[model samples]
Target: MTAVSPHKKEPYERMSEPMATLSAFAAMVKKEFIIQLRYPVEFVASFAQIFLIVVVLTLAGLMFAPDGVQSESSSDVTGLVVYGFVLFIYLSDTLWSVGFNVRREQKQGTLEQLYLSPASKFAALASRVALTLLWTGLLSIGAAVLMSSMLGELPFHNGPLALYILLMTLSGTFGTGFAFAALTLRIKEAANTAVNLLQFGFMVFCAPFFPFAALPEPMLWIAKAIPLSYGVDAFRSTLMGYPNGFPELAPIGVELGIVTLFGVAMPLLGFWLYRKAENQARRRGSLSEY
Candidate 1:
């Protein structure tokens, strides 16, 4: 009998090039943009809701002012206070918007399908966060400016402050969002409740309505420890002409540094937790169960 030839096997595939990775990222980004465009209601609602908040706050501020003075001004305490309020709203809202979107996708079974792709999960998540953050920040700032203009003026001692606030806000908000996204991977049912509670907490502790000094001795330090407070402090200083607020409540540089570290760490941590949750769901065969 003739000897049988050993079966030949195909060579291993080559690693993907840098261009291919960029292409994958671009594709995911496009997909996110398309989804956002299709759901135009969300954008409209976001704009309307922001506008309503601005109007309500403006009226409330006017009502509470000592008289013969506006809630916001180029100089003095009201502008700083209002800036703090606006900053807290912006940061808290950004986190909620991203968290809710993640929860919805998780429930709809799309998140798992996203995991099935060969592209990095972090890249996909980052793209989504980037798009949402960019749009929401713009909307929030525009609303704040328009409202302030109606009531008074924005009180920007320096226009560069806007860029600083934007960077710091993006860093802190996205960092916090990563933590929430990780939590959702494991605790889908309680995600919204958790986010709502956190949002309220930020409003109370980190916003202008309350001063960091007003907290109890123990809690005063705790408030300063939180990232959102640093954000509020930064915006308070820059937008409200309260530059003296810097490096006191919290330094802008330190907050930015901490937030940057969190930005890097939280996403990595989130990705790891997400993978674990995905595997657990898959093993239980409940990937699409929500």
Candidate 2:
């Protein structure tokens, strides 16, 4: 009599690593949408909330405009405010959503089981990014169009370069999201506090609502040091055709270099950090601890 094996490989168990990772990613993305659909009210509320904020901010900018100074009627001002808001929407969503998902998994006690599965951890982290991009893409576009109509025509120049900058900025933030996910694994629920701190911090330091020159000298110095600040500066400046005194942090070339480095390097570093944090959680037997 021949001994028979008891184990049976699942369908995708036979897939190559890349295919398996892709399959897992697609599954998680679908799961995210399904989960999201369970709360239609939240989506409506979110859209309304963002739209209100955009209206308030646009009005406030017009209110603050001095008659002879920084004309609110200037499309330059419109592009500055609206364009920066676009990056703010994305960065806010990326940072908040990614970290929140990780903490949720930890509390649900599935974080450990997820780590044990053969599915790519990177893909799991990326699924959150995919969802954030979709949700924020809608919110940002709505905000932009509404603001453009209120503030005046939007200046869109250097089209290709502006898109490249936008892509790089988004990619860079995705990497930051991964790093935040790593921190969530360690900090657990305290991650929410960190998220608020980061959310407000990005608003102030990244200067998504106004020009960097409007920042106090000390704050401008701080903004200069943050890579995302360069992203905000470069993106809007490029889109506005590098008008007088634009790209406030550095030369366009220098800003481009920094953003490119951030887009390239941060993902590698963030994923590496996430893997380290995850391993520590698993080995310490604290993956399920909240």
- Please report the candidate that would top TM-score against the real structure: 2
User: Taking the tens digit of each residue's C-alpha lDDT, what string does model 1 give over 238-261?
Assistant: 555454545347566776665556
Compared with the true structure, the alpha-carbon lDDT of candidate 2 equals: 0.89
Cα TM-score per model: 0.79, 0.94
As for candidate 2, its clashing pairs are none
Give the 10-residue window scoring lowest on summed lDDT in candidate 2.
Answer: 63-72
Clashing pairs in 1: none
lDDT of 2 at 211: 90
Runs in model 2 lying further than 4 Å from the true structure:
1-13, 66-72
Show model 1 residue runs off by greater than 4 Å.
1-17, 68-82, 158-162, 208-210, 214-218, 239-286
lDDT score at residue 228, model 1, on the 0-100 scale:
62
lDDT of predicted model 1: 0.65
lDDT of 2 by residue, 1-290 (tens): 97766785555448788899999999999988999899999989999999899888777767766752235478898899899999998988898778778888877777878887889988999999998888899888899899988888999999999889898999999999999989998988889899889989999999998898889999988888899999999999999999999988899999999999999998888899999998998889888899
**Number of the top-ranking candidate, with lDDT as the measure:** 2
Candidate 2: residue 6 Cα off by (Å): 9.8
